[model samples]
Target: MSDSSVSLRPGSTIGILGGGQLGRMLALAGAKLGLKSHIYCPDPQSPAFDVTPFKTVAAYDDEAALRKFAAQVDVVTYEFENVPAATAEILSSLKPLRPGANALAISQDRLAEKGFLASKNIPVAPYRAVHLLEDLKAAVAELGLPAVLKTTRLGYDGKGQRVLRQPGDAEAAFAELKPHPLVLEGFVPFEKEISVVVARGVDGSVRAFDPAENVHRHHILFTSTVPADIAPGIAKHAAMLAKVIVVALDYVGVLGVEFFVLGGERPSLVVNEIAPRVHNSGHWTEAVCLTDQFEQHMRAVAGWPLGDPRRYADVVMQNLIGDEVEVVPGGIDGDTQPHLYGKAEARPGRKMGHINRIVRSE
Candidate 1:
């Protein structure tokens, strides 16, 4: 159960469990530090494959292939939280899985994640577990309407969730949201969404970047502006709570903690959700910080000292979702830094790439 002794040298290979854009960024960060990455995913068109030669196109449940992949890497980490428990167990038996299986398990379920946060005395939206139509009605009655119904597992980017605006929306919403074992959450009319990306080292040291103000369009993250325009004390409090949460989990690598700044004169925060890896909200760090979130994650997972997360400038990171990628700025406006995910296709709601534009000159 103890992962304190796990550390990697410069030439060590990191085994990544998902081949999304996050994995691609992790691989690129590892390379910058004289390290290597091996991406394993079932998708042949995984964008991460373009960044590293060390890759395995195998299903998560393929135990035989998993073992082969594990043997080649020094340590294991995942790009996403949905990595199966069985797969985590198999890999942890062979190598050190950073942020550990417990963290993954908790974050994978919306109900469990909220429960865990509440147990830790972390402020979160009021929620109830829903497995039946009656349960949904009871939750709606108890928590009121305009709530969110989400699957306990296997959901992301607004994929497996629906809002219940009225009392009558229960039966249809429940039936539509197949796969029982869901969670009903009370909606907090939040003023703004913010997120803190914190890295916890193998030896218990923690470093958190400044929380970023996030904006979403049609349920997809549209932009993240760093050095969020919020009360200084509130920002500091967010960072402190984030570090405490990581310590409680005995977590290593980067963990993203999103929050809803509730309506008030001085905003009070309610935890929205947690992502167990480097998050999209922290992408602005690459444009304004010396030690970005990706590198901080690699540092933590490798049992190395954490880098300072101080920002040098304020930046806004805009995601190029779907058709947004079609127009690429040719640096005529020198404020932007373009990063394409190398995905071959551009479909609706698909994340193709991003551009980090420095908003404040400092």
Candidate 2:
């Protein structure tokens, strides 16, 4: 059940379950609101450790650590969707877990997420669950060729996925992603990829940032542009879908809903996935909106009234992946707002930070 009456006054502490860049940003946002953030993660070297004064370097399954961590904070939230179910269960039992365990459980697996969306009357790519190699072959036959096989859990940024363009690719694809439950999805001929980021208050009132049009490189998000080049109604409808999912989950905090915009006389939308927390695609909100996604997330999890989700400027947010973080000095511009994650390594495909460039007023 959702914590409909959750209310955390300023100066209360928020327990964050992951200590990646998202946690770092969330911590920064929390500080601005006079709320403290306590980061709990297995890695002592977690980037969020640098941002928040209170941090717990302990594994998710460490019940004693979790109990102590929960006791110190007024409420808990997570930075990532792959937070272990056991972790969420323990945390929620101890403190108010915004966005709740149900959102985490459903969004953690592709099969469950798709099924939940479809059950809510949202359109999704045709998909089938694949358990064995033979199930993979059979699903490819049913969904037709050019389908994608992806792990049901812990897959992100193009990892844990394989494309099967022909019948022969099934065996190899299954082998590559084997040892984990998988789901096969027929490829949607999408003209553009889009996402909507929204925040739902404890009272169930919701507000959404404008949809962002996205482009990808090597399966990772490369850029997201606000005022997505789509029909107004379509953008409005995309926000509606995000609202529908959040309300259904009785979610608090920011949620991201990704979609594929299929082209025709009138373009249509298909639900791709649900992000239970702040998303990469909504990064533009930091520079362009009166209230950024991170702060909005902090507000929701803290049980405060939501800030404006309205975009004041047309912006493009570009991620500085890997060594791209090294070029920050030369990349600075009058209009570009650069945000660097205090990470030590710049390994390939790693999201180090992002820059937002406001193109015009909205």
Tens-digit per-residue lDDT, 1-362, candidate 1: 24567788899999999999999999999999989999999998999999999999999999999999989999999999999999999999888999899999999988889989999999999999998888889999999978999988888888889999999888888988868898999989899999999999988899999999999998899999888888998899899889889998999999999999987776799999999999999999898889999999999888899998999887899999998887675542677888889988899999999999887655
lDDT of 2 by residue, 92-125 (tens): 8888898899999999989999989999999999
CA displacement after TM-score superposition, residue 39 of candidate 1 (Å): 0.8
Candidate 1: where is the Cα deviation over 4 Å? Answer: 329-332
How many residue pairs clash per model? 0, 0
Give candidate 1's total backbone clashes. 0
TM-score of 1: 0.97
